[model samples]
Target: MANYFVGDIQGCYDELMQLLSKVDFNPSRDQLWAVGDLVARGPGSLPTLKYFQQLDGAANVSLGNHDLHLMAVHAKVKRANPKDKLEALLDSSEINSLIGWLRHQPLHQELPEHKIIMSHAGVPPQWDLNTLRAESLRVTQALQSADYVENLLTKMYTSGSNQWHLEMGELEKRIYCINALTRMRFLHSDGRLDFECKVSPAECKDPDLTPWFALEGKVNQSHTLVFGHWAAVMGEVSSTRIKALDTGCCWGEYLTLWHLEKDEKITQNKLKKS
Candidate 1:
């Protein structure tokens, strides 16, 4: 029985299937923990959603920004971006159920036994575990509430400083959602998210923003974190504690999966011929 952590499977159903086969994934024995963004961008969004939906009990997903955007489009709260190839998903008969399951997923998943936390993106450098827990609950409540999750998801996009401030308003909530779901890459010296940087360390502006893992001093050393937003972040990898599995699979890059307890990389499947 293995607990496998997969990277952003953004509509790459074929690649995902190949990777799973390479790893010999056993739904009955192995648990699949996804870093989210299961749909969007790639070729097979519908099948990806259906696959995960079928694996309901065997899998756990944290909501990714793309997933939220898909939901928002369905709710009629936001228009679909031209770049998003989600028309198939929107047109599918299972749209309601697929998006519903995606929306109901939590933003943060904590595994006490493994002492690990899983989310689509990384936790901010300024937040400790306690603060993260509280904030996660707050966001979870807002998303789960019957009020206006679509509005919230539609507004989620920005660069928020690492610190959590209760004094923040709607914009901050949006920023928080972005930071939690997507648009997070570099952290400013003061811990603010640098939403503009998407390049490697060589191209990114120095002295202002650094990788999320660089903020380790701010987080508890005891707990492990498994995340998948930064596909470019490959070096400085950790097995027993921290892992970044999103090796840019959606961009014709390798798809990765890591087994947590064994602290070993189970599979590294390259994308199949398009």
Candidate 2:
């Protein structure tokens, strides 16, 4: 059995299917790891969720920002973004079950045998593998708890820097961990998150801001990290340890699938306009 790691599907179900076919994926045998943003911006959120659910034990996903937003919208803690095209999913009869499954999904997944870890936005520069695992579990438990809508999702919607400090409250710390694992891209030299910049490295105008993976002395060569956010980079980063799989599939780009054991990639072109 092989392991295939895919980028942000973003509801591009046709592309996802084509890519899986290219890889000759067998739900009963092959394992599929999605780096998240599974639903949103494209045309098939409900169908995409159904497809993944059918995979059962064969598929694993690291929850992305869009994925969390969908759960928040479903729980009535946040309004749906006008451009995400999530109405069909929200209106589905299985919305409750689908959202419940999504909430229980982990923020980080480690493949110790492969020396790899997967997350939506990439692991924080400050966290070691053990710390990453603990923080991920903490957030997953919070999201799966009875008061998730009020305790976690509601408090996690703030924009700008999410720097953690000892003086901050527990809720603030949780929110910071959530942002670091799911929404992080650029970070200031001082380790504060820079949410304003979404451009590729060459296009970024800010001198103080740096891509999280490029931060000096922050590379963790101990394991290969796979992530899917920062589509603007189109799966490019300075570090050899970090592999970016989001090739902007939702933006009329290709959907990337990584063959983990072989360290090879298979890509499928966008099958429809977003």
Candidate 3:
């Protein structure tokens, strides 16, 4: 059975279906891995959540920033950004169950047979794959806790640098790990996470800013890393072992799907307005 890894879906259900159809996905056999952002910013949040939630074990996801934001919005920890287009999903009766499933989804996933690691955002330049897995497990366990909504979600929405520290508290470390896995894009010259820049590398004027995968002496490189969340990259990375999968489908660009075993990329463009 083939393993297909999809880029940030946001809420583009039709595009997702078209890409899956292109690969002739079979839930009984093939496995689907989502780089995350499974909801928000498109027109099909509810349908998209139902589609994957029902799939259960057939599909796996690494939680993205938007997914975590959806949880916060549901719990009244933060106000929903209307631009995210999440109302339909929030209005559904299954919203609660869907949110539960999403909350429990891990921050990282491994396909050891293929020697690949997947996260919504690239792994931090400071840590190896083992650290990623451990931090991800911490967030996952926190999510499973009874007070996650009020306790953790309320504290994770800040912007700017999420610099790590040895003296950081448990909550601070959790937030750092969450941002590293879900919101990271570039690192400052000092190797600190920079959340401000959203432009592609070529367009970025700051010479000190470097994509996480491009940092010198970063990442363990024991396995290939697959990540999304930064649509501006247009699926380009300086490292051969690290792949960017998001092609900006939610922004009217092509949706990308990676064939893990074949090392192939298949794409489907967004449907134009009729």
Best by lDDT: 3
Task: Give the poorly placed runs of model 2, Cα more than 4 Å off.
Answer: 159-161, 216-219
- Residue lDDT tens for model 2, 126-192: 7776667767888899988998888888878865438856576667767787898888899887889
Q: How many clashes in candidate 1?
A: 0
lDDT of 1 by residue, 156-230 (tens): 543443445768775575457557445567877765666677777666757777877666734447678878877
> RMSD to the native, candidate 3?
1.4
- Residue lDDT tens for model 3, 1-73: 9999999999999999999999999999999999999999999989998999988888989999999999999
Q: What are the TM-scores, per candidate, against the unseen true structure?
A: 0.89, 0.95, 0.96
What TM-score number comes out for model 2? 0.95
| Overall local distance difference test of candidate 2 | 0.86
Q: For model 3, what is the error of residue 125's alpha carbon versus the real structure, in angstroms, after optimal superposition?
A: 1.3
Specify the highest-TM-score model's number.
3
Give the least accurate 10-residue stretch of model 3, judged by summed lDDT.
213-222
Task: Give me the displacement of residue 94 in model 2, in angstroms.
Answer: 0.5
Ranking by lDDT: 3, 2, 1
Candidate 3 wrongly placed segments (more than 4 Å): 158-161, 217-220
**Cα RMSD for candidates in order:** 2.5, 1.7, 1.4
